[model samples]
Target chain A: MAEIRLEQVRKAYGGVVAVHGVDLTIRDGEFVVFLGPSGCGKSTTLRMIAGLEEVTSGTIRIGARDVTELEPKDRNIAMVFQNYALYPHKTIYDNLAFGLRMRKMDPAEIDVRVKKAARMLGLEDFLARKPKQLSGGQMQRVALGRALVREPDVFLLDEPLSNLDAKLRVRMREEIARLHQDVGTSMVYVTHDQVEAMTLANRIVIMRDGHVQQIGAPLEVYDRPANLFVAGFIGSPEMNLIEGRIEGADFVAGNLRVALPPGVQASGEVVLGIRPEHLALTTEADGVAFTVRVIEQLGAQTLCVGEAGGERMRILVDRVDSWSPGQSVGVRFPAAKLHLFAKSSGQRVETAKP
Target chain B: MSSKATIYGFLFVGLAVTLALIVAPAVYAVSLSFYQMDSFVGAPKWVGFANYVAVLQAPEFWRALLNGAIYALGSIVFQVILGIGFALVLNEAFPGRNLVRGLSILPYLLPTVVVILTFKWMVDGGIGIVTKAVEAMGLPPINWFESPGAAMASTILVSVWMWTPFVTTCFLAALQTVPQSLYEAARVDGTTAVQRFFHITLPMLKPILTVVVLLRAIWMFNKFDVIWLLTRGGPVGATENLAILSYRHAFNLFDIGGGAAIATISFALLSVAVLIYFWVFPLEDD
Candidate 1:
């Protein structure tokens, strides 16, 4: 295992910059995931690290070697593409043995490694089958096995599970997590799915518009997002950001007003960020009133989309709290859970501890 | 039910047209091989298998068949190799790639007669630019059409030059359909450039390669225009092929039965070759 360091790496296509200067250090055996929406340059950064794309600027070092100018084959890295990218014409055994053969390994040793990988992936019975004969999940396994057989220093996965169905994606995700644990190799994974990042990454690098927005542990990034983008991107059902003005001691928008958390500095226009789960239905008089537009009952938790303070907001509540559409309810945002951001820049506004 | 019937009715008309235009002529030609008709006006005398026996016994016919094989095989080998090589190069991303691709297809689009005439002028023994250039390079002036081997080689060379682009275009189109991710994966797998071509590119191109080779083989085997225009089976029948021989027999020698027999033999040989090809290289993946 080796640490991967990117010193202000940047990539551009013609005049269009796809990845801005990104400086990151992934420690040995650490599983760092780059998470963002499409066209956010997360995949581009991953490919650059794999040496599949040339770094237009800055340097990338894997272990003690600078691989900035190296070809992908010379980088001593293995990557699993989004589509599995298995050789369709070759059998599973050949696909797994391909890298070993390319390295000029002995035939006996190649066979041994191929068998081991196949056994690990439960593909022994399908060793002679071509990729076309395999199911989506089986193909994914072959892809993972191909990388596993290489025994490279760093493993790069470029949205490898994106092509599978929902149930298969979850299974493959779990398999990848177990594989990382078993191999203990430094891996850099890129995906637009936040859930995958939240579950798989030891440290999550949230990106937006070719820029790294936040880098922190999954819970840390979830609990304390760096900005408006991270706050909205990290969580499912999304964080609710209600635009309003901060008066003397109260935040007011439209016909709604709620007391700000103590010592929350700055006034004028601000966006109040609160996770859906942080908002609660209450009968208190100090709560903001909401008109529920739609109710989505998701078994364990019920999500309600509603209008609060003249802005659309999502509130996640326990399934026990039954609220129908058109119901007018009072929602409370506890002081500890409130996230306030400057409206003009979307940067977080620090609040003093109470 | 009515719509289905209408579709079948349209299909029936198409089948009838194909049978009348294509199948009928082929059948009539094969039948004519069994007759001794000299001209269209005279009644055909039943000759049984005498015409077929004559064609098989004729040393000129056998020599012509051998020349045809050599031309077809020679042209096909060069065409496929250069086609795939050019295709691989053109598939790479470069500036003005579309313009290059458009220009590369010009050879395949030019009329066969024009290509033949152009090649004849360039390879003309006297006052030809190519001959003069070769002499300037300190090489003896080469006769492109006079000697038997030289004539066959020039015919093959010109055929390859004109048709390689067609194969290239076919391969280039097929190459585009191969997913780029496969190459990226192979590269990451530590495959060198040569290995990538053999393992990834070649295998992915197998189905299309087989089809192009089969089509070019058939077309080259039956080709008459290029040979007729360039050498006209000249220099003592050096470049004579089955198609040219059949034409000579029918038009020049006026041996209608013998010409029909030769044509029928060419068709039979081609059918056997196609059958063997299919049997040896079954297209279906294992």
Candidate 2:
């Protein structure tokens, strides 16, 4: 296994820059996921590391070798494309053996590796089957198997599960996590889906507009997002960012004013970030008053969207709680769970007692 | 009336037109091949298998069949090779690609007579560009049409020149259908450019290649106009294909029965060739 490093790597098509200078180092055997919305340069960064795209500037080093100018095959890296990209004409065995054959490995060794990958992927019965003959999940495994048989230092997967259905995606996600564990190879996966990033990545690199928003462990980024974008992007249903100002231990926005947690500092325009699960529906009088707009019952839990301080805040409640639209409710944010960001730059602001 | 019945009523009209225009003439030609008929007028006399026997015995008929085979083979070989080469080059992105592709297809769009006449003028011995160039190169001011082998080569060359664009167009469309990601994947998998073409491009183009070859083979087998317009099946019948031979039997000799017999025999031979081709390169499982 080798550590992959990129120092100020950039990509441009003519005058339009797709990826700015990006510097990152993926530790040995680390599963790093580049997560972002569409056109955020995450895939471009992954492609650069795979040597599929040329870096406009700076150096890319895999272990001790500077592979910025090398071809993908010469980089000793394997990539699974979004479409799976299984050779439609070749059988599963041939597809798995393709990279090995390209490297001129011995036929016996190729057979052993191919069979081992097939057995691991549960594709033993599909050795002779063509890609078109396999289902979506099976094809995904074949793609994974093709990459696995290469035994490369780093494995690059570009949205490998986006093409599968919901149930299949979850299943494949777990399978990929298991494979990563079994192989213990360094992996760099790219996806727009946060669930895949959170579930599969040891460290998630969240990007937006050709810039890295944040990079940390899944829950680390979730609990303490680096900026407003990271705060809004890392959670489902999104975190509630209420634009307001902090004045003398009170946070005010529109007609609502709530007491701030003690030891909080920096008084000026700030945005309060609170996740849905962090808010609780309570009848306490000191809680922020809200008018419920909608309630979504989700089996064990229920989600309520309510208007609080002229902003829509979503709160997760128990399914047993009977809440209707237009009902008045008091929502409380735990003092430790409040995230404050500077309104001017959207950067996270630290609030600690001096 | 119900919608189903209305749809069937419209389809019945189409079927009737096809039967009258295509099937009826084929049936008439088959029936006429077994009888001796005169173009001038009179009832055709039933000759049983005599017309077939006479055609088989004729030396000119055998020579014409050989010429036809060579012509078709020569044209197809050059057409497929040059067609694929040109299509691959044109498929790449470059400045003025649309204009180049449009110009390349001009030969296919031009009237067959125009292309034939142009080639005839260019290859004429006197005041001909090709003949002049040959003389300038210290070669003989040779007769392009008077020589047997030269006439056959010339006709085949002209056929390839006029129809290669059609093959290129078909191949270009087929090449476009191959996803770009497949090539990217192959590159990552360590396939060289040549290996990618042979392994991915060629296999992906198999279905189109089969259809193109099959259609071009059938068309070139019975091709008449280009050969007739260029050499008139002449230079001692060196360029006389089965289509020209049948036409001459019908018109020059006014033996309609003999012409029909040759046509029927050519049809049978072409069918066998097509069948063999399909057997050798079966279509992929759907």
Candidate 3:
């Protein structure tokens, strides 16, 4: 296991910079994820750490050695790409043994490590089959097996499970989590999927436009987002942000007023950030009014889509919540679950009043 | 149901007509090869293996066949290697790359007759630029097309130059279809540029290269115009190829049976090569 440190790392393609100057430290054995939207430079950052991409102007120290100028093989890192990137011509056995064989390990030792990885990934039966014969999930396992056989200091996965179907993505996601627990090696995963980041990462590094928006444990980042970007990106259904004036201890938008916590420091206009499940439903008299547009009954929970201040808003609720389209209902936040940010900067504004 | 049957019947007839249009000439040639041209006025009489016997016994026919093989194999080996190399170079981004690619295909587009005549004039005996260049280098002037070995070398050289561009074009088109992600994967696996070519690019190019090489081989084996124009089977039949020999037999010697026999033999050789190619690399398997 090795710690990774990026010091003022920047990557530019021509005059257009893909990765801005960023600094991060990943402790040994930490499963850190660089999560962002598409076109964000999360993959670029992970590739830099793997030495697949040249560092424009910074040092990438993997475990204590500066690998900024090293080749990918010299850096001793293995990466699982978004497409699995398995050699289509080689059998699963050959694919898993390729890195070990490249390192010139003894033949018997190579066989042993490959078998162990295959057994761990449950790929013993498919060892002799080419990648074309295997399903996407099986190919992903071989890719992971290829990395595992290397026993590299850092494991870099570039959205390895994104190619699988929905059910398979979940199963493979859990398989990755299990693999992490079993190996305990440092892993840096990059993905546009928040659910994968939320579940798979021991520490999440939320990035946007190549900048590290926030880095902390999944729940830590989810519970205390650094900015409006983090607030909206980490949660499914997304954190609902309503722009309005924070007049004293209450945030008002048009005719809707959701009271904020006491001593809230925002004056004029500010954005109200609340998770969908945190939007509590009540009788018409108790809270801010909501007219439901669509109700998605997801068995245990329902997502209510409605219009508020000319923008569509989503509210997650238990499936038993009774509401209909065009019906006015009161929505409230329990103060402790609510977040308030500055109107312009999007920085969090702490408060104690509601 | 009656209308559908009529449509199907009409489609079958059309297909048969198309097949017959191609097969009739070949069938007639085979029939002609079985005869002896005893007289020019009457239809040739059946000779029963006499034409094949005469062709096998003739030293000129045997020499031409050997020269053709040398030309075909030599052209094939050089074309595939240099074409793949040139294709790799063109696949990358270089200054004036579009112009470089366009110019590489220039030799392929030139008329075969013009190309042959130009090279002939440039390499003709003493006044020829090629001979003069050799003499200037303090070496004895050599009669290239007048000697068997030199003629075969010239034919192979010109064939490689003319056809390698075709293979290069094919390889470049195939290279474009290779997913960039595959290369990135190779790079992350610590594959160097040379290793990536062998491990990733080459295997991915297997299907296209098969088609390209097969076509080039068949075309080179059947090629007539350039060889005929330059050598004309001169220097005591030293460079007589199947195409020129067949033409000389039917038109010059008026030996229609022998000409037909030579054509059949060439066709058989080509058919066997194509059959072996399919047996080795099936399109459906990949």
Candidate 4:
């Protein structure tokens, strides 16, 4: 196992840059996920690390050796592509043993490693079957098994579960997490799905337009996002970012006036961010006047999406079946949970954490 | 009910065309093989397989059959091998790739007679480019259509040149259907470019390759025009394949029944060969 390091890695296709200078170090046994939307260069960065895409400028190292110039085969890494990319003609056994066979390992040892990976991936019964004979989930496992048999220094996965059905994706996601735990090898995963990043990654590197937004643990980024994009992107019911101005210890936007957190440093135009779950429904007389437009009952939590002082806001609260559309209700934004960002730069304006 | 009627109507038309154009001619030819006739207008007398027995007894018939096999096998082998090589080169990203691909298909697009005439012009004695170059290199001028071996080689070379573009186009289109991820996966799996071609590219192309080879084999075995135009079965019956032999028996010798017998035998041989080829390399994905 080895740590993968990228120092100012960049990728450009002619004049257009796909990945800007990205400097990141994935520690040994760490599960780092590059999370971003489509065309945001998350997959490009992972491909660069895997040696599948050439780094236009800068260095990448696997362990202590520079691997940016080496071929993928010489980088001591295995990748599971989004489409599973299994050898369709080969049986599962051959697909798993192909790498070892290419490396000219002993035939007996290749058999041993292949069988071991198959058993671990619950693919022993599928050894004689071709890729077409297997289900989407089974093919995904075979893809994972193919990488496992290589026993490389690092594992790179490019949205490996994106092709499976929803339920299968969840099951395969669990299987991947379990595989990582069992192998204890460094892994670099790329996905546009925030849920996958939040659930599986030890550290989530959020990106936008080829620039890193924030890199932190799941809850850390959720609790304290570094920028407006990160704040809005990291949450399920996206965080409400209201365009407003900070004036005299209060945020003012149209007729809405909410007292700002104490010791706020910014003074000009600012964007206030607050998560849905951080708000609460109170008596009409207790908090700000909120008119509920729609109510979504989500098992234990009822999400109230409506206008709070003429600004769109979503308030998630414990089951409140009493609420309905066009109902007059009061919602309170806990001061401690309120986040603020500079509107000009879109960077977070640090406030005291409660 | 309307859709069903439409399907049946289309099937009836297709069956009618097949019977009229293909089956009818085949049946007429087979029936002709069992009769004795000097010309199409002459009274054909029922010979009851006498023409087949007489043709089988002739040494030229056996030699023509052997020559046909050699020509077909040689042309198909070279065409397919060179076609695949050119397809691989054309598949790669290059500056003028589209232009090159268009030019590569030029040979296949040309009329067969035009291509044959061009080949004849290129290898012409005294003034042809090939003859001039051979003389410049102090090598003996090639007797392209004089010697038996040279005549056979010339025909094979012309056939390969005229038809390799068709094979390359088919293989090139097949190469496009392969997913790019498969090659990346192979590279990650520690395969060099050669290994990747053999393991991934070749296997991915198998289904198309099977069909292409079978089509090329059948066409080359029965190919008549290119050889007829280039060598006309040679100086000493060297390039006289079954097709040429059959044509000569009918037109030149005025032995219509003998020509039909050879044609029937050639058709039967091809049918059996096709069945065996499919048995060895079935087109369906396993």
Q: Which candidate is the best by DockQ?
A: 4
Q: After superposition, how far is residue A68 of candidate 1 from its true place, in Å?
A: 1.4
Ranking by TM-score: 4, 2, 1, 3
Identify the superior model by lDDT, candidate 1 or candidate 3: 1
Arrange candidates, best DockQ first: 4, 1, 2, 3
- Tell me the TM-score of model 4: 0.98
Model 1 off-target regions past 4 Å? A309-311, A320-322, A352-354, B1-5
Per-candidate RMSD, Å: 1.8, 1.6, 2.4, 1.3
The alpha-carbon deviation from the true structure for residue B169 of candidate 3, after best TM-score superposition, in angstroms, is 0.8
Candidate 4 C-alpha error for residue B157, in Å: 0.6
CA displacement after TM-score superposition, residue B118 of candidate 1 (Å): 1.5
> Local error of candidate 2 at B29, Å?
1.4
Q: Number of clashing residue pairs in every model? A: 0, 0, 7, 0
Better model by DockQ: candidate 2 vs candidate 4 = 4
Candidate 2 at A315: error in angstroms? 0.7
Find the number of clashing residue pairs for candidate 1.
0
Q: In TM-score terms, which candidate is top?
A: 4
Which portions of model 4 show Cα errors greater than 4 Å?
Answer: B1-11
> How much is A190 displaced in model 3, in angstroms?
1.0
Residue-wise lDDT of candidate 1 within A7-109, one digit each (tens)? 9999999999998999999999999999999999999999999888899999999999999999998888999998889999998999999988988999999
**Candidate 4 residue-wise lDDT, A90-162, digit = tens:** 9999999999999999999999999899999999999999999999999999999999999999999999989
Predictions in order: chain A TM-score: 0.96, 0.97, 0.95, 0.98
Q: What lDDT tens digits, residue by residue, belong to model 1 across residues B158-248?
A: 9998988899999999899899999999999888889899998999889998888899989999989889888898778888999999989
Evaluate residue A97 in candidate 2 and report its C-alpha lDDT on the 0 to 100 scale: 97
Docking class for candidate 3: medium
